[model samples]
Target: MTCSATTRVALWATLLACLLNSGCTGTRYIPSQGQLASPTPPPQALKGFDGNARVELNLPGGYASPDDRAYPTQRANEDIQNWFADSGDDLTVAVRNENIKDSGWLSMLPYILTLGILPTWLTTEGETVMEVKSGDEVLFQNREPVAYRSALSMLLPSAYLLGSPGTGQYQVMADDQLNRHKQALQQYIQSQQKDYETAVSAGTVQAYRQYLQDNPESFFRMETLRRLSELAPATHALPFHRDNVALDNAYIVYLPDEYDIWFLGPQDMKVYDVLRLSREEDETLLASRIRAANQPYKVFNGDEIALLKEGGLSPGLIAAMIDASANPTSVKPAAVAPTVTSATSGAASPGTPSPAEVTAQPGMADIAAQCAKRYAAMKACDQVPSFGANVCRSQVKKKYSHIACELIQ
Candidate 1:
């Protein structure tokens, strides 16, 4: 029975539509380069049930089948470019090499999975499959989903091994993997050691000192001590003991070769000459010593004091000085008298008041004024008058001394 021409045309059109619809409904093979067409039935509209209705969790669409895995092959390349753009020159070069070797794909997959673009899959007996919802939509089934796993695995791991082929580069690609593992272990050890040293260096002074003391055999400790001596010469005398014996009013003098001399008790009449020499001839060294001595007292002024404070001086030293000053006895006259002790000069006369005494006398305005005049005259002389003589010759000095004597001077 042959159909009429008009009926035959209508029947052929209906059959064509059915065929097209069926093709869209089922999966179709497409080459990697082929463009994908929109799926039939599109996606189903999600439904909500009443509070009491048994709720079944629906796995996201792409996660169901391995074939449906949406590996972001294109986006991965974009990310690599972005990474290189933001990185330093060295890192950029490293990334380029890694990409060339296909290692970039391996490293990127983990990241894509985190972004929800790649679905997780399990492999059993060398076959990889994706989890999918069953027909009833109530249960999940592990089915072999379509994906490019073999290609990705081969490309990524191969690339990774290429750029950093193990500890010693070998011709065999398999050996390169082993070398990388060894190199990684060594790098981790070095990093840990560096962290340990950094932590030790950042600790408190006492802690650092203890470390040095305990590690005296270490070369590093010796180097540290040498540096400390060069920077803070006076630190050698620290941790002073009572038996260390105070120098009375002695001043410290620096010698030619980084050596120091302690001139004991400048206040004593016998050492008065040495004190004078230290003050006038060794002014620089004397100043340094005075500064060091006064450091313990906190109120002493000098460049070292400024530096020590700036470098975080111990609070203990400042507090101790304060405590000492609180006691009246702590403040005493310097041991050495101010006298001219040059080799060309004779000894000072007996009972002569010292220059410092003249300055310290109470109500000594007239004495100070007279002394200032004498100072001018003496300064004009070939040799300046002895400090004791200047004080004794001035009437202003007598008046002030008398006043001081009366008031517990």
Candidate 2:
């Protein structure tokens, strides 16, 4: 069928517009020109935790579960708190809301004229005061400014993208603000690490106290406490126990300063065995082992459990491991004790390659190399005398923790 002259002209114009605007297809933030009317405050160095941090998020009206979203307050609270949940309660994080203005369709004329090739934004602007407190003392408080804009174009499916349109405008703004807050927390935690290591090097009771005082939510608190006890025994006191203490203190157990592994030692064959079991999603054998607690391994600590969890172990298995630790059985020494050495540290050592450090076989070589390289970096970071070696190792392992080599084995 032949088109009319007017139709043909329109078709050519449409194709030209698509080509011209191809660079701006996705729903993304428009680059800010000049300065924002209200600049967001940079995230400050404060007390925070990594994977094992116990955080209690407090919204304006108080705690709200993600599962219970019946009310507007609960729904909004859940949107902000969903990503921040972890294991510890070193600090109480409160998010106070402010006025949020929804700027709908900045300009309609351009979009109409360009036949949806030119995009328009649906924006949500707001500010939130994120206050972190250790007991009654406010450790770090900052204003997190939220300016989220979703680009709408016929070529861009905004609804399918994160922070997209079609949701309640307020919810979109809250989610973006929360994400920014999460990033800030990460930066804040890293900044605090340098000071923590400095305090560790000082190796005095006062230094440890200062670190604990400054970073109420530090992942190194348990380590600091142990040091403090060794330096000044009388001052050591029991910390308040929570429901998930095993999960909370897992960081400490998994990455001890001494690279000691008693079971299947000098080689982390047993460690790889657990990783393999997790990959197979079998927790029954683990439960059976937990029940028969005469196994010649040291009771799994919180950090060990955390490592297992990172390596893909199930929660039930972790719980069983925790129980075995809590209720110990008199372990008879193995008839022929396994060698205990640095070989099980999960990093390659000279002379012999640890089982865990062996290069992946065939097709899986690339991932194994990446994993081994990352673990080596973490080990190097831990070797720095003043650094929180355990903390560094834990954080690094969290990123590339899965035992990829276990797949081939």
Candidate 3:
């Protein structure tokens, strides 16, 4: 179909115009750089962006249920008192207001729904103060007895004692409550000590050991150990031999001390049974027993070790536990493995600087001076210890040990 030049030119022009207007052809898709205009505003407010919005921190298991109403009035009073004590002054009212306003569940309900239910009573009255006198002397003055009672109830459950106001009392009763509580605890400890003595006198070591083994979680462990340490023999014969020395059980007996020695049972079948050796020979004999047939052996200090031993742990495990117990600000768990060296032999050698020794050792004065010279370099010494003249000695020794071992091979 042959067309005139003017007609062809006109058709091409129309096609180009259509493509440009539609933005459908010959268009590259480049992402927009500038701010984009939204068709609609954001559907919901972003978290933390709602600055004026109220925040509610709900109780763990929500409000008490019908089953909890057995001691309804008392429980409610206790809860109110606990809240006041913890929040400190006017907290009950503030919390109630917050709960009503910010709670999503409460807001969704009809206004009439709140009117149908009885509202919880929260006392707004400031702490009451009272003053009292006995004869010519003033015994007590205006005191917030309720607040103190509430605080004590929450802080110490067993220690809180209820008291009745005396005749014509204008002030809260002042009794020796703290002294009474302390006396009660002391009495209990004394009673426990007597019972422990009786148990020791009446039973054999095996019986006592069995009692300890069975009731591992008993709070009496420390007391029992104290008693045992006192009763343990003072002297031993050389090459002392004891039958059925329960190493695992002894671990449960004493708390870990610096001088405590753990004798590990042999690793292989041909190796000897494990024995725990103390600094004192007699104590070792007391703890040891002749190896029994068919007794199970553990590779690492397991639950058995923890259950029996005072520290109930191996040297490696004890070191880890000690590191864990250190203050978070002073010590970090991640740094423990790389720092502390467990004493495998008699004691860690003085010549060898353990990871702990390395960390604990202070930087040299020269290093500190060099660091002080530069404003940005002040904290550089904290990265590693700067030893004085003895620097690099350990490193060189370690290298030599490796070389010597290789040469001998």
Best by lDDT, which number? 2
Best-to-worst ranking by TM-score: 2, 3, 1
Q: In TM-score terms, which candidate is top?
A: 2
lDDT of 2 by residue, 68-112 (tens): 212224444554333333434334566665776656654446765
lDDT of 3 by residue, 211-278 (tens): 45554433244344334444444443111112112322322223222111222111221112222332
Looking at model 1, report the run of 10 residues with the lowest lDDT sum. 42-51
lDDT scores in order: 0.26, 0.43, 0.26
What pairs collide in candidate 2? 53-88, 54-87, 54-88, 54-89, 55-88, 250-302, 250-303, 254-303
Error of 3 at 137 (Å): 43
The residue-by-residue lDDT of candidate 1 on 190-276, one tens digit each, is 464464366457554444445444543231332233223333335433322111112100011101111111111222211223234
lDDT measured at residue 316 in model 3 versus the true structure, 0 to 100: 43
Clashes of 1: 14
Error of model 3, residue 253, in angstroms: 7.4
Q: What stretches of model 1 exceed 4 Å from their correct place?
A: 1-99, 102-297, 300-409
